[model samples]
Target: MEFEVQVRGRTARRWIMFGMIALGAMFLAIGLVLTGVTASFLSDAKRARGSVVALEWRDDDHGASGKTLEHDTPVAYPVVEFTSADGMPRKFRSSAGSNPPSYQKGDLVEVLYRADSPEDAQVNGFASLWLLPLIFGGVGLGLSGAGTAVAMVRRWRS
Candidate 1:
């Protein structure tokens, strides 16, 4: 006996395909932006050692869900500040949002900054990482979405 898989069922497959395509597009966009930002930071890091900086939560605006609009407050986070290769002081927020450290106006933070540029630096072992992955993820999603859309359209036609 021979078995065959037929794409006949009217199913959620269409939705799934659409989602993948959308995700791919989003990831692609994110990746591009991250690449640029990371490149700029890298140049700065090469020039000077990163300096520790304080990040005070700014004000809060309307959140998407609006469940806790006040949650947007910029509690304190450890940040790395350094001059870029172009002699510009750039500050990067720390990746310690899970449980931000108590911050003072001028708290001392340890950072490994580049000599040529201060903007490119890692603070408290936190670097501006994951930007690339995010971007790629978006691109992959977009492509997947496009493919899914095609598949779904074919299925619908049949």
Candidate 2:
């Protein structure tokens, strides 16, 4: 009975380790795909200079209830306006937002977009392009490294 319990415990630990590693690997794969997509978009993207015309504000509750004493801060996303390569006017709200607001009204920023779809434009910056992939990849590496370390310790103990 004692031996059976010990074997079951080992099996459970192994399964948990495998689960973490697998999940991490999946995240890593997703990050890699996103990196490729971002690279491809940048390669085909056209550049234009845009100015912040306005700011769109929204409550960033962080999943907390309004009833709580803690107040939710508003996040500001910049609304940019610019002329496309085809001399057509375009406007788009940035996907990223900040608490204090990253951009002020009339602040000029570089924009990147495809000529065929100028409305779907993004601010040309490192944070706009590479932040997501870096985050996913970093998390994946941390999780996978932790799982591997656990496995190594277990093996060493045995």
Candidate 3:
């Protein structure tokens, strides 16, 4: 009976350790992806004058009836049109959106893009360019740190 209890305890410890490692890996992966994306965006980034073609809304629907629907602050992605360094006309939808709609049709804005692939672009601004990577990287670092702390504590205790 005592031996069985000991085996069970060991199994539980292994499972817990595995869980911590898996969680840490997941966070690290997220951090790496965000860092890579940010790096890619910054590489060969070119700026151009563009105009917002329209404010598009992504709507969210609420509970059971579906008749009672709620809109998620009416955020809109700016559809920007610009000419690339190679003089190719390109239009892209900025991934960044905001509540109360940040832009309107025909609004002039700065656009940042890669010369090689102008279709891959973003509206030139701090939020559009940097917010996601910063937030994701910060959270990932926090989670990874916590996981490492847990592992170290376990090793010390053992």
Candidate 4:
């Protein structure tokens, strides 16, 4: 004989608990990856002075031409030029992305790069270097703690 089971509040809460655990796990994994990348960058980077050559902008409006200029949400990318230790002039785009343009053309900025290859250079700032890991790790820790607490509470209730 086929059996029909009635869903209870506890069963629904258990499903919710599982969902929270999954979300928390996903964030934790991303946070760990970002932390590792940040660690690698900090280990062997040399500081150099670079100048912003120009601002590159990309419209966020998904190729919607003929739209009003107000709809153009352009993000600014700073193109930096620096001379490596080998006396070769190298130009690279900063990895930092922002709206309203944090830098201007001809602005001098500090850049950090590996000595052997200057192409993988990044702007020398907390926002450029550690912001991603800090944000991901903070959110991951909070969500994971909340999920663990919820699982414990559900277990106690059962």
| Best candidate according to TM-score | 2
What candidate 4 gets wrong by more than 4 Å, as runs, is 1-9, 61-72
Once fitted onto the true fold, the runs of candidate 3 whose alpha carbons sit more than 4 angstroms away are 1-10, 60-74, 104-106
In model 3, which range of ten residues has the least summed lDDT?
Answer: 66-75
lDDT of 3 by residue, 21-54 (tens): 6676676677678778877777769989999987
For model 1, the stretches where C-alpha displacement exceeds 4 angstroms are 1-16, 43-45, 50-55, 58-62, 65-74, 79-98, 102-127, 131-158
- Better structure of 3 and 4 per lDDT: 4
Best of the candidates, lDDT: 2
Q: Each prediction's Cα RMSD?
A: 8.0, 2.2, 4.0, 4.1
- Candidate 4, residues 38-146, lDDT tens digits: the string is 7787788877889999999876455446564766687888999998777888899877767989899999998888897788999887778888877777777777788
lDDT for residue 3 in candidate 2, whole number 0-100: 100
TM-score versus the correct structure, for each prediction: 0.44, 0.89, 0.71, 0.79
Task: Estimate the overall C-alpha local distance difference test score of candidate 1.
Answer: 0.58
lDDT of each: 0.58, 0.89, 0.78, 0.81
Per-residue C-alpha lDDT of model 2 across residues 47-106, encoded as one tens digit per residue:
999999999998756554445235677889899999999999999999888889889999
lDDT of 1 by residue, 18-54 (tens): 6667777677677777767666655554434554555
Task: Return the lDDT, model 2, position 68.
Answer: 26
lDDT of 3: 0.78
What CA RMSD would candidate 4 show?
4.1
Which rank order by TM-score, best down to worst?
A: 2, 4, 3, 1
